[model samples]
Target chain A: MKTFLFILAGIISGILGGMGMGGGTLLIPMLTIFFTVPQNIAQSINLVAFIPMSIVVTIINIKGKMIEKKGLLKMIIPAIFTAVLASLAVGRTKNAVLQKSYGVFLIVTGVFFIALTTIKLVKKRKAEKENEK
Target chain B: MSKKKETILYIIIGLVAGFVNGIWGGGGGIFVVPLLVYLMKYEERKAHATAIVIILPLCIVSAITYILQGIYNFPLTIKVGLGVVGGGIVGAFLLKKLSNTVLSYIFYTVMVAAGLRILLM
Candidate 1:
């Protein structure tokens, strides 16, 4: 039963992630809240779980020639540097503190998405109205 | 943007996104996609594709760090990882048929609710 729940959580998060929504945000919380997984462990699982999915999609995207190569290295080099530093830092941070901070992050992300969606919806409606004339 | 400014912007974007992904274990792609689309002037599809490419390496590095830190559950990760891969395929198909705005509304609502629950816990 416990194993089933974990897989279910993964599937749910994966579906959203597959659609390019940030599934790890949902996955970590689900693990912590439903299964009582520790924040650090849950985070580790999320990072690892993302690996195969990303590899497959990335390969497909490359095959389709969807990736834009311009300036790619500029972004990748610094991102790799900081990601290593931050991952090490997270290893030392307290789990409770990490959990609370992640909560704040999720709320901010939710609000940001809501605002973006609302603006898009309004613009889409206006465009449709204009087209009717 | 000028060439120098664009280069600086890309680095800044990468640094922030990587930090967020490493600390939080994910969500960097969400941060990257919009920056690529709005600031970098990438088309939406290209931004999404590029964001994935950028995030893949970040996740790999972060995962390795976490494993080295001994923050890993092998059996659970395997089960969950397989399920996620299966669901991801389904999601890819759904993306073509669904109205993204409607999906976004639902997704964000759940996110806000989940956030509140976590905060209050």
Candidate 2:
């Protein structure tokens, strides 16, 4: 069942990841909730799990002609800076707290993403309406 | 070329993502994609690809840091690593058939739902 859950978690993370939402939201909790793994272990596992997903997405997108080289050049540094710090912190957390943290983070990120998306949608609708006039 | 701006943003995002990744284990892609697509005007695909590039370095750095700190678990990481490898292949192949717009709607929707579920549950 947990294997299935991990697979499901992988799928969910992959799909959401490809779509540009942060994939960690799906993955972190899935690791904790479904597998009953330790938090530190799960966090590392999440990264381990996500690494392949990120690479595959990169490779396929690159093949499909999705990668924008110029954009990549511009974004690489800042992205790495944060990723490194976050990875370190993940190492310190306990399993139980990590589990709850995953849940809490997911909830917060989910709400934030939705709210931001809605705002964008609303602004877009207003823009279109103005343009049509 | 806004070298300063790009560099500054890169550091800030990198610092933030790194700190987050230390604890969370995922988001270099998550946060970076938006930072690139929304803030840097990267197309969706480009932003994602860049996320990979960004993650690669952090992966190495973090792995090393954890090992040095005596917190790293190689045997376990290896197993999960194997899984991620396969998963990446699957995700890559799937990318060809899927539309980002459609994917985005689903992604955003799921995230929203996740948020709601978290709040309620």
Top TM-score: which candidate number?
A: 1
> Taking the candidates in order, what DockQ does each have?
0.85, 0.41
lDDT of 1 by residue, A15-79 (tens): 99888888888999999998898999999999999999988888877998989999799999999
RMSD after Cα superposition, model 1: 0.9
* Model 2 lDDT per residue over A7-121, tens place: 6566666555554456655665555545656666656656655655666666666677766665444445555555555555656656556555666666566566667667767
Against the hidden true structure, what lDDT does model 2 obtain? 0.61
Q: TM-score of chain A for candidate 1?
A: 0.96
Query: Under the 3 Å rule for N, CA and C atoms, how many clashes does model 2 have?
Result: 29
Off by over 4 Å in 2: A1-5, A18-20, A69-86, A123-133, B67-121
Write candidate 2's Cα lDDT for B9-66 as tens digits: 7667666666666566665556666777677788766766766767766665665555
**Model 1's lDDT to the true fold?**
0.91
